[model samples]
Target: MELEVKPRIYVVRLGGDNPKLSTALKLVRLGYAVRIHAKEIPPHSVVLNPFSREILKPSDSALLRRYGVVVLDTSWNSGLEDLRSMVGRRRYEQRVLPVLKAGNPINYGVLTKLSSVEAVAAALYITGFKRYSLEILSKFKWGLTFYELNKEYLERYSSTKSAEELIKVQNEILRSMGLQP
Candidate 1:
């Protein structure tokens, strides 16, 4: 039987703040991901950018399978300057995750404040890699909670074929929650 090849997961740890609590660092330790500098991100890989205008879709799975995925691990306290520097002119494809509540201890229940691992897992899940996504999240104590909290949204988002569809689903979810979309 031919061995299956998994997409590479890369995390760029900015400023190295609170390494102990870093889910991205934990993933690296568990041998599920790699630590790399911002400049080292492979060309055409999907870079998780919260500031990105483009929303991630199931179609992007092809890019993830071929060029892999990247997440920038940084402190919320770290100013946008750090993030802007990395995302400003990068060759990588930048895509943002839809609004989802955090499940990590630090920012639990807060919208769009997922931990690094949560962000990576969300990307994988959105791109049709549910098994790998759960496997990565299983490594964290509060990992599964992230999935539980966002399962409805994840399921809906993953089924979307395009960014527009994903946005429409996100809006519907938000409207149902009585929040302005």
Candidate 2:
């Protein structure tokens, strides 16, 4: 394999919603040939990731196959269902889930409240995060953005979080994300 920067373009597909598809398609239209790898997706948007093998249903996969997209259902069996071998789903998961999860305590309403230094709020939430992990998602929520909630979720825990502090963190996170009350 040859070395390259941003070797492939990835699209986020969760069950049935792909908010970034339009953005990605727009990029494609601008002359960027990108490779798409999605998880779950909604109907009507099948035409977006026409070449992805990592899709939701066998039937949908077949339809996408016609468009050149491959379908590999991660639910039919146990164990890690990885698309990296074919398209690289791991990269997308690694890139988006952490931040999104960390920011989960915060919300759309809380986002607006974020202080001038967004990093401070983010750091406050992710502090002591020597390690972390992410939650399994069935679909992508637009509120989380491309990085998910806070990006801090991508690591394993080195220390445990306190219930009180966690509550405070959660509240702060939500407030920062713009979730009022």
Candidate number achieving the greatest TM-score relative to the actual structure: 1
Candidate 1: pairs in clash:
none
Clashes of 2: 39
lDDT of 1 by residue, 104-172 (tens): 999999999889999999998888888889889999989999999999999999998788989999999
Tell how far residue 57 is off in model 2, in angstroms: 30
Compute each candidate's TM-score over C-alphas: 0.94, 0.22
What C-alpha lDDT values do all the predictions have? Answer: 0.87, 0.28
Residue-by-residue lDDT tens digits, candidate 2, 46-81:
222212433222122223222222122221122123
Candidate whose lDDT is highest: 1
What TM-score should be assigned to candidate 2?
0.22
